[model samples]
Target: MSREKTKGMSIIVKTITRLTVGLVLLYGIYIVLHGHVSPGGGFAGGVIITLSFVHLVLAYGKDTALKKLSKARASFLENMGAILFLSIALLGFMGGYFFSNFIPKGEPFHLFSAGIIPISNIAISLKVGAGLFSIFVALVLLKLKPTSEKKK
Candidate 1:
């Protein structure tokens, strides 16, 4: 493969993808942290974050996204995040029934408030983001064919 013309174009695309993905990640973090006090939650933030990666895959290509993140790793993260959230909820059961606020709820309108809600949001964000991102990647990869392979 010649590294001439493709270099310049790839550099530009890489820069744009990095910036967009970074912003999306930051926004997702913000939404998750403020879930207890704001309208958005883990699920919403997660979707937004995943969309960022989807954009990267679309704008740049599946190969670039896959280079940054492996399919297996992404799937593992998604499962782990779900497990973490479920474990937290199970812990609450020990207190009484379920989701019993095992942690101390600070004050309303504060970061420390909402006991386990904030944590759960973070977990869900991780699970949903990675899961959705992986799904998108799989679909894109499925459609991509080696350039060397000529059509019949």
Candidate 2:
């Protein structure tokens, strides 16, 4: 197949992906935010977020997906997530414990009721999502390298 033809999947698949990708991303965010109150958490939410990108790549090709989230940006986000998470943990020192809950815990079963848990979840989600996406991009590049070399 020509490079253009090989870039993405069929139009039907692309259409479906376009329709659903945003919902997938939204759901991931929901998972991350509600993790402290529910079953899902940072890791699960991050995987969901990564899958949204993966779906985009599968349906619309790497060029489109990379335009949205470049590898460099992904690395930056990963680093920022790590720094944020570490900072949150370090701040707990003021509470006289590592990873202690320093912020006020509001009423139960409500948003913002978990002190720093939601913030930590956001940090973990950023780290895992970007890291996983970067790994996927690297693997995709690695697979393409040998194929292009063979053609050359």
The model with the greatest TM-score is: 2
Clash pairs of candidate 1? none
- Model 2 bad stretches (over 4 Å): 1-6, 144-152
Per-residue lDDT tens digits of candidate 2, residues 1-152?
67786678887998899899999999999999999999999999999999999999989989999999999999999999999999999999988898999999999999879799999999999999999999999998775335676788
- Give Cα distance to truth, residue 150, candidate 1, Å: 16
lDDT of 1 at 7: 38
Model 2, position 109, has a per-residue lDDT of 98
C-alpha root-mean-square deviation, candidate 2: 3.5
TM-score of candidate 2 to 2 decimals: 0.90
Off by over 4 Å in 1: 1-15, 144-152
TM-scores for every predicted model: 0.82, 0.90
